[model samples]
Target: MRAADRFSFNHATAKFWDQREAVEACARAGVGIGLWREPVQEMGLEASAKLVQDAGVAVTSLCRGGFFTDPTPAAIDDNRRAIDEAAALGAPALVLVSGGIPAGGTIDGAREGVQEALSVLAPYAGERGVTLAIEPLHPMFASDRCVVTTIGEALDLAAPFPAEQVGVVVDTYHIWWDPQVWQGIARAGREGRIASFQFADWVTPLPAGVLTGRGQLGDGCIDFKRYLAEVDAAGFTGPIEVELFNDALWARPGAEVLAETKAAFERVVS
Candidate 1:
């Protein structure tokens, strides 16, 4: 397999560390990177862009861009800016975590909000050469993180748009438990809508918010090799990004974490 065919580390894995150091570590380890938005902004976009460029690391995707469940003008405006940022960093896809239920709102209402928001942003993202990858967070997060909870649902949302403009993110950590996973992957492949493929292990007794408990490769029950086979069979070829949100991992040194993560990914997928 190609080096890029293996795994890329998401900055959220080392959320507690410095952003520049994380990029450098990933490059040195010969792995690509998935960047987050706040750190990029805090370090200054121009500087962050230059740092990644200097390191010669491929950025697989930008961490986020969708939270517009309300579809307010302000929310749409923010996502537009996110698309521009993804383009600036040379990231091919922008991961969209459709916002959760608005206060005093029904989940059905939030779904509508996500659809409306995507309709508004899809064209802009397409014109800018950025694809929006809708990520289906785990069902545990359905209440407050992302309303889109399955690959099938995400594809349904993407059906009306051009494949280049809208797609779905398949993160094993989030969707591994779904019984319909294979069919979902096949559908995404048939539609040419698999924009980003991320990896992380799944463990029990999740953390409080359920946002930062992602396990490292091989540490949990996810069968990554199976996923690789399925995705490849579906004719979807893309970087496999490892996006762990573990608190323990975040507390360690960034370089150490990257080195360990690389080794774990290789062991599991080799």
Candidate 2:
């Protein structure tokens, strides 16, 4: 199955892991990877690109490139650079975590900023063969994270572009709680907007900033098999990237964490 064949490790899962070691670990584990921007920048984009390419691992998506709600010229320029980096790294999609409400700004206004930013970047992304995967973060992050909180909202934002240019990322941690999740998945498939499918189990009493509180595959309320069924049924045959941001996972040995995560994913999804 394409979905099963495309399992990936989101670098955020083991953030403390060294960049080179993480890529090597992913290759050793026989999985693809969703690369983060900071580490890539730190390692120097060319060096990071060469390492991943030399490892022969697929770079599913670039961790992020949006947050242009303020839409300053500087922000747009940065996004453009991200698009180029994604292309250089052979990443098919660039995940966009649309910035949260700017100071004193309403959520509605922040969303408008996302729309505007998308309009600016979508074309450039299209030209570079990089899809912009708008990730609708969980509502818990509506205040300080992403403004797009539902698959439906992401689709609406993506409606203006061809599926190849603009699309949505289905992360279970963010959308599992939505009552309308199934419908959203169906819509994404029907509209040809499922650019990336990510996974992260949901846990309660979210951490302070709600950034590093993701649950492991079998440790939370999410039903991985069911999500797999839904996305598969919706015809989304892409990499199922596990993107847990748990502090505990980050504290462990990278190889151990990767092995555990892969096993948990297989156990839950089977």
Candidate 3:
């Protein structure tokens, strides 16, 4: 299939854009989308599901469903609801950002929380035909954002569950700096744990909020072609979701951003 054919826009890339408009745009572009829970909830789960279903656009994966470092009952219950939402939207995977250490808690303890949370949710997700996709953010976010900081680590966390129930998200922006990333991708693929693959460039001179500092494709240090080659070599053939979080891009008109992102994706990785 053509590279463009596999393109999937992540809604977070255009944060302020209307969810319905984003779905329509993806449909018009004949691409797929990765949705988030907030807008889905605002639109009402059933309404959001119907919107995508009517648009005939593939919902590649739901943005998130994990933050169980503390692993309270509330957290576990929320993740279960997230799984149900993914099933409702026909999203095959629910991307998980395992929360960071709680107050006075150690990183190892936080990881344990992730495992505990997964043990409870993986089977629930599988029953709903959704895979729990663990996403390892960059180590810079290890303290406040995600405890899982490497694909290898994410894979290790997913080890106890069946591949169909639990997997990892290979997001370039987060793992590009890791020397072992290529090996991790290969291992994830070999183990059948590649549930989602996303693209984002890493730029220096990060903005005030590092979380929103991801660069557009081809605009930063990440080598898109190499990432594409590596993941492909690892045997993954799924939607290539470009999930940028740049503040500047978010400020632009969503449709224009989508068009530019699509063009950039083709230019850099095709």
Q: Please report the candidate that would top lDDT against the real structure.
A: 3
The CA lDDT at 128 in model 1 is: 96
The lDDT of model 1 is 0.89
lDDT of 1 by residue, 1-270 (tens): 763356788898888779888888888877789999999999988898898999999999998998888889999999999999899898999999998999999999999999999999999999999999999988878888888999999999999999999999999998998999999999999999999998899877677746778887887888888998899888877788888888888889888888888888888877
Better by TM-score, candidate 3 or 1: 3
What clash pairs does model 3 have? Answer: none
CA-lDDT, candidates in order:
0.89, 0.89, 0.94
Q: Tell me the tens digit of each residue's lDDT in model 2 across 25-121.
A: 8898889999988999999999999999999999999989988778899999999999999999999999999988899889889889999998888
The residue-level lDDT of candidate 1 at 235 comes to 83
Report how far residue 42 has shifted in candidate 3, in Å. Answer: 0.2
List where candidate 1 sits over 4 angstroms from the true fold: 3-5, 207-209
How close is every model to the real structure, measured as TM-score?
Answer: 0.96, 0.96, 0.99
Q: Lowest summed-lDDT stretch of 10 residues in model 3?
A: 1-10
Under the 3 Å rule for N, CA and C atoms, how many clashes does model 1 have?
0
Clashes of each: 0, 0, 0
